[model samples]
Target chain A: MSNPFQIPEQEQHELDQLGAELRDAMPEVSLSEDFHEHLAAKIENSWSIRSAFQNNRMIRMAAGLLVMTLAAAPVAAWVGIWPQQKKNPPAIGFEIPEEVNVDESGGALGDSEDNQVTGPNDEFEAVEWSPQRRVALERYNRLVTAVASYELHGQDMELARFEGFSDQSAWASASEESLWLEFARRCAQADLSPLSAELVARCTLMLAAPLDRNASKQQRAAYAAWAWLLEGEQAKAADLQMNWPSAPFLTQN
Target chain B: MSPSSDDLLTRFAAGDPAAFDELVASLGPRLKGYFLRQGAQSSTAEDLVQNVFVRLLQNASRYQASGRLDAFCLRIARNLWIDHRRRGGRVFSSEEAFDRADPRPGPVQEADSGDRAVHLRSALDHLDADTRELLELAVLQQLPYREVSVILEIPVGTVKSRVYYSLRKLREQLHNLGPQEDLS
Candidate 1:
């Protein structure tokens, strides 16, 4: 009911004085022509090194792929550990069987380029590249990776398969989950709205979607809380306040 | 007419060092002022200003014309400052360098000037990097928070909050340390 940021009148006065002082403390600098030449030369030297290091296309693409994989892996595992279940029950639309195969059969298409699983929505196509679509795909990938990492195999493998991303070949493995988490966290923390927003959206979707038996009850609940936050459902988020194992780092608490 | 900053960057990337000279001519003063406002000594600020432009030359190919030119330059400058700070050469103590060591006209040395400047500099030093950078960009350089956010890799909301908090802190410190102002 009360505003937390209400500064007292006295404090406000103090702040005004500080502002005036701040205005006066700033320094003045003037650049000369000779200094500019020296700087240019230094930069030229650094560029030569950078060019030498990243000159090849294969190296660059490989590096990009490595970063993507590392970033996506922990997310897959986290998703794997989370629970899932079909929403709307069997009452609304056709419910796919819970035991659909992810890798070999046409289930959630195991992390391969060939397979494409059809979702409940008849019109919903596979991941596309528009801003919204990219966001959606990134979310899906992250959720799949997190769930997969946590041990939800089917959906994990399914989402990966659908997205044509492989845990084994794509540079994301059990060992690299920590690195991926770091990358994702750093990227999300920075003002990369497209990346962070997608992370939020996918996190929401993963939370909103029903969880399966293998998924971590606490992680699923946390995802649900995360989803609730994304949906502006703070009340529901408050309700799912379970003591999740992925407590400290994952929730940003 | 001399090439614009953007034009020089493009030409420099195309291997024309002369274009780089034009860029340095155009952006040098602005760069120098940015470092100075962040409390660098004039000579030190000038050095870093030159370093920023040279760093730009190395990374010229990375510059996209569609991107914010000023923000790009500022980001490079911020990185250079961080590096200089990390070298353990420049810290809060370096604030005195700005006030006392610059070659140009600096803060007036009235009876209260030294104390006032010292208090303000210390307050800024106490602020977070994001807050300090935003204040430098927004207040000192007169840039909008939008561009500051881009350069600092923070959201506009964050930029606003940081500037507000840093300013609040600075003002509080100033009032505590400087001559009292009438609050009528």
Candidate 2:
């Protein structure tokens, strides 16, 4: 393999120039003047309540540290009690993760006073995700694990085309026009009487999305191998895995 | 993906209203634009920007920034996007019908003038999700290749070459659309 980084000087110069043009061509996104003021006001009004339910422990930890400091101050000043001068701005005392305040609508939830808290964890229970989303995530993880661990699932291709497919839709849209679709069609109709028997049924419901009807040959084989693994037949999956073409699935791309 | 001054973030964490305004002014729009480029809707992009501000309000970006504040912020935006994907994924609920047009009303909405930027955007939409993201970070976000490499967790060389190929592909798509524009 030739060295990728060692571009000739002429090409490197062209690339550098191209880079500047690309930057200039891509116009910058400018916000309205009021946007900053409005967002600042909104954060000031709502995020404290948003933070209270975000995480209970961080506040408790901060409070505990404060109490420890107060107690130690008296001990150190026992001989001559003195008051400590306050800093210009009081410490906020807690840090929040970037996503802590957001809900699906992309805003803080619970506008009513109920979201307000005198102390962290004092008011409402801060459930980040509801029960339904939690279960869906869990099932998705299981399917990813099953598919990813399959010996035959070694290709580096991505099936990210299905941006908006759900289990129900996948099942509804299943057709026998192609092998992967046929696999999905069968899986969609899966009966759950036995765990092994339901492997096909779980295929669409569990994975991000089933293979498309027009998926490449390797895509179909990849799905078939996952079905085999989901049914506990690793050897069969491995055998089928060998026939995959140069590319693989499950990469970020 | 916006440039946030670590110093301003530190002041904001300490509850300075001026710093808060400055940070929001500087970071909010660009961050929202980044989200929009990554395929989020207008409302969703606004929400994503607000969420980043909320996190910044809680502490100094200084805590995370080792001199590369933009990288630090972009990493947060990326994680929020991943979380949004999982929560809003198709399993438990259905997505709004996927619209081919961006809903934000601005220079991007000019559908009739044969705007070159519009053509560029349409061409960009033709690429796959990952490739689009790579180009968005490396080019649109204006982050250095090394910074983008760290955020995307890929080699700097690979990032540069991929950006080259992606732009080449995008340029071909653009040429197919019309004749006046040249990304070369």
Candidate 3:
């Protein structure tokens, strides 16, 4: 009896013949050594850049940052600084300092009293506060703590960003003051600079009151306060602010 | 097959640029010819080959020599081609397209050296891109119906029938072209 599943030998022969024909028809192409030389050169050009990015140490650091950012909340909770869950969102009871005295005096954190902060060529003043400014400072504190807590996990940086650290909504609804402060804090803690410095400067300006009132005086205070915060030099910042030739932009609430 | 392409790849990853060079040199011409036969202009074929190497460079660290290098390389080429088509429609003339479409087209075309290359290439132009790719992989690649099924992400049996159906269509197209040049 003939096999049931077997393809007829004749049909198989035709297939083999066709397969052979197609194989023979395939074209032969060769690469010139010139191409190889060019490729080698290109690789050499890209080598350093790739090596810089692929440095095992940097990759490990980035990976560590990612893990930290993702695990921050849990870690923070474990350390007893943050809440375990958001069953009850905390009420907005944070205080905004009236004039962030940037003069060189206070605690290990820095002096809070002398307040005579000044700016370039006496153009900008030291410390001045507004309702909006207060919120910003509080937000900055929260994000700082968040990042510090995150760093404990040793995760990658990009992954941290992916896991909602970069989500605008996390800070968007925050009072403009809070948002600016948080933005400042993020800049400060970031591994890189330029953008952070600019953001800090912008945050100070946005919180400044209408120019007509203290006008020249207010500018000096804003700059002094900004300079102090960035350098972690509070006493001098405060001293510069106190020397301002006009009234403060903020009043204690 | 050969030692796992992945093993070769891992060696390349261990700073053996020579290994990478050899890999590229060995695969380069065939890949270029594969694209060219499918109707890719020489420049287009060159671009595709270059892109494959560029990708190899970028993902060298991720290359797993345990897997089939041919499959991995083919997968990369296939993805690039698919993306190219998605981004800018079809790239090759139908014959060249058919010739370039299969991961194993070089062999397929080689096997059927007679009038089929010209006739099939021409006839292939009449079919949709997907059908042409399916037929090329099945008939030319001599890929088991199952492998074709896996590569194209389709049912196994579908490959055989599709291959059979596409060949029939190609033959019909050849017939329609009249008894001009014999693809004997």
Candidate 4:
């Protein structure tokens, strides 16, 4: 295509002469002799200010990471101690079903006469606690604590605690399936009827685990509805609730 | 050979203070002329120039070597001008302020060439703002059409057409002023 800005050869020459005449007619304006010096000083001052700002940003980032790591250290230690502490003689009334036992040998434990057992105790002795299993248990316990804390308190403390355990470097060796199963078991064992928005959210994320092939459609829908409600997607949650296949087990806030 | 403006900008970006000095020296007059021609007072032009350089330094890291530094600098100057306008500051008209007080006689005027210069300045004042700016960029500043396009954020074709019409109008004004008196 021809250049749009181009003019005919003769007109171009005339325009050039006009340009030259205009340039000649224009008054000459020069900057002060110290113009360059003043400009350089201003540039240097600005550069220093910008450098300080960037340095401040990097320092703030480093400090934030440090604060986060320090805050997470104790929770990480608590999670690490959980699996070992659970290995003591099974709490008196804690019982494990045949199919879902997590003991090292994968054997089912005898049923307990009392069903009021509380706290972190090994109800089952069937599956051996491998290093991987220990890490998974740690994650499970951390998430459970996070959910419980969020329900009792508010989002901020719970989020900090969750972020603590969910830090990638801390749980690098744990398998997601193991942690997921533990989360599911913890949720199932707890009475979810008094559910908080926080617990509902945790349930939604945990239920998304691929390992739970046995969960009924109603259970999935219920979890999904709760997730939607907690996420402020009230309309979607209401729609799902209206078409629910069965009555939801969890209480809606 | 002198370094290209882009080269100087790249050096400045790389933290060479002297390169910044080189840039200021090279582009300072043109920038001042731009502000003056656009009707800024000499002091205001100087202040605007300082502001432009300050902005350039602050945003140096964002400058891409592949881009035109001249256009970039002019864009900053234009934005500052717009901001000044928004703040409700008066922009003096260079052509209307025909009797600008200066110690030095304007470079183009010899002992007897003042009338032609006055006529040209008066003619320039009559053009609309956009047309005058287009003429300033294409003719007085001598920027390439492409660079003008970037600075004004317009198509080169538009710049060309506008320049053509602006020059035609200016030529008519100059012709109507009749012949210049003999300069011999």
What's every prediction's RMSD, in angstroms? 30.8, 39.4, 21.1, 19.7
Please estimate how well model 2 matches the true structure, expressed as its whole-model Cα lDDT.
Answer: 0.54
Against the correct fold, how does model 3 do in TM-score?
0.47
User: How many Å off is the CA of B171 in candidate 1?
Assistant: 1.7
The per-residue C-alpha lDDT of model 1 at residue B45 equals 81
Docking class of 3: incorrect
Return the TM-scores of chain A for each candidate in numbered order: 0.20, 0.22, 0.24, 0.23
Residue-level lDDT tens digits of model 3 in A9-68: 776555456545555545456764566766666666665545555646687788779889
TM-score winner between 1 and 3, please give it.
3
* C-alpha RMSD over true interface residues, model 2: 4.4
Q: Could you tell me every candidate's TM-score relative to the true structure? A: 0.43, 0.45, 0.47, 0.52
Off by over 4 Å in 4: A1-9, A34-37, A44-253, B1-3, B95-101, B106-115, B178-184
lDDT of 4 by residue, A151-194 (tens): 33322322122211334333333333333332333333331222
* Whole-model lDDT, model 4: 0.59
Off by over 4 Å in 3: A1-7, A32-34, A41-61, A66-253, B1-7, B37-39, B94-117, B141-146, B180-184
Pairs in steric clash, model 2: A155-A248, A155-A249, A156-A248, A157-A248, A187-A200
* The best candidate in terms of lDDT: 4
Q: Residue-wise lDDT of candidate 3 within B103-162, one digit each (tens)?
A: 445534543665545654555567777776776566654556766777788797777767
